[model samples]
Target: MRKIVHIDMDAFYASVEQRDDPSLRGRPVVVAWRGKRSVVCAASYEARRFGVRSAMPAITAERLCPEAVFVPPDFGRYKAVSRQVREIFLRHTDLVEPLSLDEAYLDVTRNKTGLPTATRVAKTIRQQIRDETQLNASAGVAPAKFLAKIASDWKKPNGLFVIQPHEVLDFLAPLSVARIPGVGKVMEAKLARYGIRSVGDLRSWDIFELERRFGRYGLRLHELAHGIDHSEVKPDRPVQSISAEDTFDIDRFRDELGPAIRQLAEKAWQATRKTERLARTVVLKLKTDQFKIYTRSITPGDSINNVDEVSALALLLLQRVELPADTRYRLVGVGLSNFYEPGQLGGQTELFGNEF
Candidate 1:
């Protein structure tokens, strides 16, 4: 069994705000744009106590905690801190897979420091992060990625937990089905209809029966109920897509997206050029104020030429949105995908072109 560790920074954006501004310490802090359509980026534990949360509208958050201090997100500073934390992880193991700016998975089964166990590595890394950045990180050590991810979140705000191979089943049993990753509100409701409320309940059902109901996911459910996950901590995965997006301070009508689309396309074009890979497709994405998502993609007859083309294509796709008249959107995004390394660019795949 491999020894995996999941490290998650606690209330990352909000914590950084509090750390930088001592006055915000121990007070409800929300990182968000201040407007009717703006959504919370991160909420401190103090803010969460008043029901404020990430993605909640700023208006709702204001109603929840009138005294909550709001600060705009500073991604540049967060990315810098993330790099420092990653350097600390590299001291122990090279098998690091970052999930976001605030969390990552490390396969420390064979660590460079010659640590006797994964728990020691987790503790040492957490302490180093605290000492270097003055921020708290929680850790979870387990034999598999799934278990490690769950264990890391078991305790929050400077806590650590472990899940031994022998205790896997015992640890998974009796827990709510929602504890499983990917079991969102919709999936939980679907499982509830079949009287499956816990991991134990899931295990009691026949594997074939699960497959019959949930298809491929049902087999995954059976394995997870028994605490089995074979996925590895993949490091240095190739870039499959490059994207940039913006959320408007106020919801926008269809006619208002041209400028945003052009801006995002320029941002995406610049971002993609920084990589060794070239894009073969363009994608347009939009999200309504009600959270409805829509994506339109085109592979085109050839690879993208410039930002102007991307803007034109994105605008064309915008016209294809089949929503009702006068529908409003809160977010717009543009991206490039179907990437091929520069060395692989001149290939027969260009003749037929790929469809996204």
Candidate 2:
């Protein structure tokens, strides 16, 4: 069994703010942008007690936690701290998979520190992050990614949990099906129809029957139910797509959509530069005032590079949208897909698509 550890920063953005400003410590903090359309990027544990959460609209978060202090996101500083944390991971193992600035998976089966176990490696990494960044991190060590991710959350805000391979099934059985990877609200509802609400309930179903009902995902459900996840931790997993989107406070007319599209395209381009791959498809996503979502995409003969080129291409895609006249849009997104690694660009042929 491969030994994997998941490390997640606790209230990352809020913690950073508190670390920089002494007065902010021990207070409820919400990290978010200001303005009508703004959504929270993170919430402190104190703010969470009032039911505020990340991704909640800033306005709603304010309503939920009237006393919460709002702070704007600082990706630059967050990225710097993230780099420091990653350096700590590299000290233990080369197989580090960063899920985001605040979280990562490390395969420490052959750790460099000569730690006797993955749990000890996780403890060392957490301590280093605390000692260096003055921030809290949660850790989980397990035989697989899904379990490790779940275990990481078992204890929050500076905690560590471990799942031995021999105890996997017992640990998973009583948990809600919602705890399973990829089993979201929709999947949970579908599973509920079959009287399957927990991992134990899911284990009773036949794999063939599950495959018949849920298709490929059903096979995965069966494997997870049996506490089996064969997937390995992939380091620096290849980038498939880079995207950025905005929600407008007021509905925007079609002719008024240029500014939003351009902004999102620039943001997406900045994200694209972080990857070693090139993008061939320029995609435009929009949501109408009625909440109807639509996407338009094109694979140009040339890979996308600059902001002007991508923004212009995305604007052209808007002309192709055949929404009824007077249909105002509430959101706009810019994305680049169909990625090709540098070496593969020589004979570059497009693969279907993948989600990042």
Best by TM-score: 2
Predicted structure 1: lDDT:
0.83
Candidate 1 runs further than 4 Å off = 238-295, 298-316, 322-356
Query: Which digits, one per residue and each the tens of the lDDT, describe model 2 over residues 287-329?
Result: 9999999999998888777778889999999999998879999
Model 2: residues with Cα > 4 Å off, grouped in runs = 242-282, 285-294, 298-319, 323-356
Residue pairs with colliding backbones in model 1 are none
Candidate RMSDs in Å, in order, are 8.7, 6.8
In candidate 2, how many Å is residue 121 off? 0.7
lDDT (Cα, 0-100) at 144 in candidate 2: 90
